[model samples]
Target: MYKVDKDLLAIQEARIHIEGAKEAAIELRNFTQEELDVVVNKMAIAIKPHLEELAKQAVEETHYGLCQDKLLKNRFACEYLPQQLANQRYVGVIKENYEQKTVEIGVPIGVIVAMIPATSPVSTTIHNAFIAIKSGNPIIFSPHPRAQKTIQRTVKLLKEAAIVAGLPEDGINYMQLVSSTSTNELMNHEETALTLVTGIPKLLPKLKAANKPFIYGGSGNGPVFIERTCNIQQAIHDIIESRTFDNGIVSAAEQSIVLDGPIVEQAKSELTRQGAHFLSEEEAMKLVNVLMKKNGDLNPESVGCSACELAKKAGIQVLPTTKIFIYEQAYVSENNPFAQELFSPILALFVEPNWQEACEKCIELLMEGAKSHTLVIHSNDEHVIREFSIKKPVARVLVNTPSTLGGMGATTNLFPSMTLGSTSLGIVQASDNISPEHLVRIRKVGYGVRTLNDCFNESGNQSLHSKDTQESIEVILRKIINEMKE
Candidate 1:
């Protein structure tokens, strides 16, 4: 037998999986909402008992994020996700406007090619599977090479549970032969209707080239603004908690702190009291060197590391109790790594004269990298909060809460999702946190309420040829001529 190249093997595997998924998707479309919910609920229940075990597996394999936080993410995906999607309609006749004599029907988007990231592999896998099934679509996941085993294990368990619950075996599949060629094949497959991506920025061009509609979960350079009217203690605590959670691997976590000049000292004091170390200018430069690669991308080695570990890597001495490393900066720019999304337990601190200047700083920081992802504002004044909400370029403006938790819907009312969509200034289809509804297309049924004559009559165009209108037009023309002659 002739030896086949690994890339060719991967492509063949992708084609096989896509074909299977296409068949499964057709079968899934026949399932009722209740039946689909039953399967999804069973899958969630099956994974509920293995949350901690899977979290440990993910941490061991990927070496990113804390196992404890991963467990919380797993629970959020398995338990909270199902609850949030339980009563929601994603099938036929989802909405009806009786007054307008129209109905909205939901149809699945077909086989979804989902790309899983290494940062939150297991939880993202669970969330993607649940949403796809809930929307009556079959999904094939291309796991990150670093976290392939963990993601494969997650998909295996979910597939087993789904099969036991009467779903097709191919309804949830993961690529066994993982490679770029395989990923591209999966995306370009004729059966593939959409691609759901939650990974690095490099794969975007490839996804675009596949000529398929894609929903991307881009990065965030989230900035938290501490307005003067905010409670200094609570604001500082929220920032620390969010930045340190999961070692700041969460994209929605605050990367920069814009503090009002009036409360700058108080905020720093609170941050210091809460185990944050403010880095000197020299130390900050050291971190910048290690945090980013020569090409301006985040270094994988520094990502998801604790502040103490980062300080050690940068050769800066700090207490073991340090939970966050802060870099006080005078400006925001591409040259400032602190202003960009570090994806670690480090934050840039900026002091502004007022809320207006602070808002401008936040915008600048976001524009540098993380626009349209998320922004946090801690303020007790409704007026200030409202102002930030309107002026910020971020899709989700979290107020008075941790941006990580708030953006993911753990602390706020936003939709619960592992894959956040950056729709405003970023390259995603939807701006809100993704849900099952995003996986389905709405087919609107309309009944004609008015005739063409009615539209023309309503616009008052029928009377344009009347004698009064002609006289008015002639009078206006004569008036213009008289003025010109004068």
Candidate 2:
């Protein structure tokens, strides 16, 4: 009876927010591109000084990830994201391709539902809110139960700044009263445009049941392949750095390392030198159970731990300087926790004869682990690199860079984003790093380039074709310009 009352209260809260958000979305449609960018910029500036504080608070509240690393993530959202977003237009008429006799207008997708992950609460919230407002969409955030205080604090901070900078009063919000029922209410709400879930794969069924479009940033157990011809020391360095960043909480981080057969020993030596502690057979088995729950899934409790911390939990002794916990893995299966996403500074090592067999092994690991997300290759050989790129089912294929930094656009050319959209994981929505452009629909305007004579002509006739009608495109364009001026 008590639970029912709380659920009802939560539902009420969701409905209120959704209603206000719908109104806000309507108001936002009248905002020009510059107006939306101003609100986003103001919010980003207001949140800039508190980035470190929020990172600390997030770490303190969730007990996940290193505080310093989380700070870097927050800075990435503040620093890199804004520079990229500033020049890009996401509101009103965004493009006019005069040559194609077409124009593209950016239309807001309406109210959005954002599910902030406990693992990346602050960074993901900032990203979701920034992009949402940038695209002129009102957004309601649902904080993860574990990181409620951190996420709520972030949303509160951004909302205040956004409104002060001319955003609608109810344009941005977060659910202080969170429950499964309440979250479901938001997802299923008639006003909810789409649900953007970051690092929470469990909600897919509920999101699907809602019958609304959703973008998901789910699991990643992508393999980082080090070819025989690659620089052994540099490859090992990239892998260790990637897997240990934020204690491996980032989904794009390397979870497995696939090595070509001839250079296996040398690469292993290099990895050890670079602080990856290889576990013995007995030690590996002991840690397997610790990393797995009773249902044979990756244990959530073991996620986002440093190498030393993960080692301690598994009752294995290791030097404090250890940067990664390494386990030599042969087979890929559900029962093998090494084959799964440990989500900590732990990696499964695989040895294959060549790039062809290595590619096969990577596919097996991807299937057994994260379904499909990201893959990395370290090699100077363009042929091998091209082959890996062509064959992988993952969304992003990073080359010659650390997977975490490269995948997130810090070291690569990907759009700066926290939401690494999992393509082929079910949704056909966004298969790249999500940005403001993904939050809105493109309204294309194409002028008529042909008449009924040209269209219905069964016989090949140039006179009845678009060549004669090509002159009309300029007239149509001038009329469109006149309409815009009016």
Candidate 3:
């Protein structure tokens, strides 16, 4: 009897998916915008019915988030995303400038290799597949090992629905054998046009080393600042709801809270009323060990754990109504674990003297833990809101809204997406909420309205603008084409 090497088998599986998707991509290029839209509509309709099963399976397997919240994520991808992408055009002759004699065509970026996160695997998979098909590109997935079952099930359903609606057989698929070696094969393949990554922070270095272009939706340590003028009740409500949703596993959830000094006492009262459990000094210290690993990275075990669960793990008892865990800190520093993104229903509180100091504190938190991700400001003052908007270096700034819902477009008008393209972390080239539009390249068409001499001779020499001074356009074109052939 003979046994095959698992790494070699995984690598072989990676090649099969890529090769199949490459062939499907060629067929996809001929699809009209109407045809693509029909396919997406069918996928959404088909997947909507299975959201609950997939959500439950995801929670049971990964044990990372609540089933209900996960179901909402599924609905967002299947129902909300399609409506958002409904009227979008991504095919030939997208735009034209009559006066300039130019046109723009939307061309697919070819086959893509995408990595799915364990945290939001099902939703991200569904969303990535839909957008890839809408833009006329076939995609392959490297499912996170922990969520492989859910992801594979999703791909199976998506592929079936897509094929029934005229997508090529391999238009959407996932790796049955997932390994780091196989994932690299997909990313570095010559036929793979782009790599889409989600929630894989540890793979940043490897992603950078790859030769292909990638779009990464990585970690966020987005903080919420409650200014003096903000509605205390509303601000605290949104913060708790957002942070506690899905046990705070979503990357866009608030990591900390900064309060304007004048409202310190009042805000603390509101936070407590809203189910926030402000920890004692000893309790905070215990959770610090549970939340942060010895290497300064997030502790895997604590992720997606509720406040009550995390408290029990840390050897502390908390009220059953506790929705979030808050630790008050006097200073912000790189050495502080609370300054980092904990990825749980845990938050650090900082009080500042004024908007200027609060802004500085938020900036310090971002510099230490996040890059181009998200930030939230709760205030009714127009000037203060404008000031923070002007000074912050983030992708999306949510004002008077919950960070999670607003960032993912649940309660905002931004595009509905599963991938929040966090920039400045590594090789990701885009900062938009990942969508079909980002997966296509724009091709420009020009009619040569003027001669090169018209541009080159603007400094004094007479151009070929007049008939008498012009070389025949046909003759010039023939000469250039003949030279190129030679």
Candidate 4:
């Protein structure tokens, strides 16, 4: 039997609070672009200090992730995100042309349920909450259980900021404890107008089953392919950075590397120089088999583990100072579990004698995790990059830069997001990164005439039979007359 936690009760209460807030939000049909800007900018400014504080509290309480990395993520959520959405109006009316008298209006979607992950607890919490508020929707967030303390503290900070910013009270609410049942309850709630779910694939169907509109992001298989024509040193460094950042827990993190030609050796040497320790062939195979369990599911225990942690799992007393461990395999086979996503600092290397084999292996790896992900290639050649981007079905094709940062929209100009969408199998949209614009729907109004004669003059006259239009009109009329006579 399962007992309901008080935290769950608090979440239910928040849901009730959001019920009224949703109505108030929908009442705010239109806002000027300036007003929208003020709301967004103020939210960003208000949350900036709060985000930093929450990031610190998260690291302190969770005892996971580096404080610096958390700070960077916090900056991304508060700074970059607002900058992107600034001046974008989701309010009442938009005038297309005053002379033409066209007006487009914005309609709020009411309350939303945002389910966030533990790995990106604070950043996502702030991002989702503010976006929802800006769009005139009240939000209730359910954080991953492992990072509940961080989520609770962040929500408190955000609420204080919102109030200071002159937003409604209880505009943002959250769950301090999380569980599968609690998530299911939130998703299944009848009052939830929309859902923004970013996590594993298993929960997507449940959100769908809730029969509520949703935006669910899929997993990322994220593969890095190295061509012989590219710069080996840069490619090696980029791959290492992508595969090891934040211990490779990111969905955009590179899961495997496909290297071809003489550059294979060069890439290996560079990777070794960057603190990647090559495992013996026997040790590599052993780790691969153990990590990928027989049922084809990723072993949560081994995912996102450090090199030393992995070595310990193998009963090897490796030095704790090891930065990254590389596992080299001659061939990929069913018995080999290297095809699975190992979230840790383990890099699976497939060295090919030629580029063709490397590209083929890259495609094969994507198929293994097809619809829920992204793939990456590091090539300076425009032709090779274009070809890979065109052919690969993955949502995002990260090039030259590190997949972790580039694919996540941090260093790149793309939208910074923790969610990667896959379009191949309807797992998610084809968008490489998701944003607040995705959650909105706009109603366009057409206006020109107020009277029947005015309507005819403005619209009906446009398609009338003037001399130039007579030829086509006669042809159609003749065809119809002939058909009637027959």
Model 2 lDDT per residue over 1-486, tens place: 344588899999999999999999889999998998899899999999999999999988888899999999999998779899997898888999888799999999999999999999999999999999999999999999999999999999999999999999999999989899999999999888899998887898887787788998867888999998888888888888888898999989988989899998899898888998999999988887787777777777887878787788889999888998888877777767677776888888889999899999998877774457889999999999999899888888999999889988999999999999876666447878999989999999999987665544534364533754455556767898999999
Error of 4 at 380 (Å): 2.1
lDDT on C-alpha atoms for all candidate structures:
0.87, 0.88, 0.88, 0.70
Worst 10-residue lDDT window for candidate 4 reads 453-462
Which is superior by TM-score, 1 or 4?
A: 1
lDDT of 4 at 313: 83
User: What TM-score would every model get versus the actual structure?
Assistant: 0.91, 0.92, 0.92, 0.83
* Better-scoring candidate (TM-score), 3 or 4: 3
User: What lDDT tens digits, residue by residue, belong to model 3 across residues 1-486?
Assistant: 899899999999999989999999999989999999999999889889899999999999998989999999999999888988888898777899999899999999999988999999889999999899999999998999999999999999988888899999988888999898998899889999999998788777888888568998868888889999989999999999999889999998998999999999999998888898889989988998898888877788888888999988899888889999888999988888887777799899999999999998888877775565889999999999999888887777899999999999999998898899885766676886888888999999999865566653454356467664455555667898999999
Pitting candidate 2 against candidate 4, the one with the higher lDDT is 2
Q: Clashing residue pairs, candidate 1?
A: none
Write model 1 residue lDDT over 361-476, tens digit each, in one string. 88887777545688899988898889888887777899999998998899999899998887543335677788888999999999999765454355555565678666766887
lDDT of 3 at 471: 57
Off by over 4 Å in 1: 294-296, 424-427, 448-486
Q: Summarize candidate 4's per-residue lDDT along 1-486 as a digit string, tens digits.
A: 989686667556655655755664654444444554565577677678676677777766655555667788788888888877776666566446778777876666767888877667888787787677667666788777767888877777777766675556656777655667667777767777777876656777786577767776656666788887787888888777777776677667787788877786678878878778888877776676556667877666675566777777876655566668777777665445665666677777888777567777777778774543777777777887887877776677877888878876886888767665665544232355766555556688887556543333445444454664566567878998999999
Q: Give residue 272's error in model 1 in angstroms.
A: 0.3
Candidate 2 shows a clash count of 0
Show the colliding residue pairs in model 4: 29-92, 30-91, 30-92, 31-91, 31-92, 219-372, 220-373, 304-344
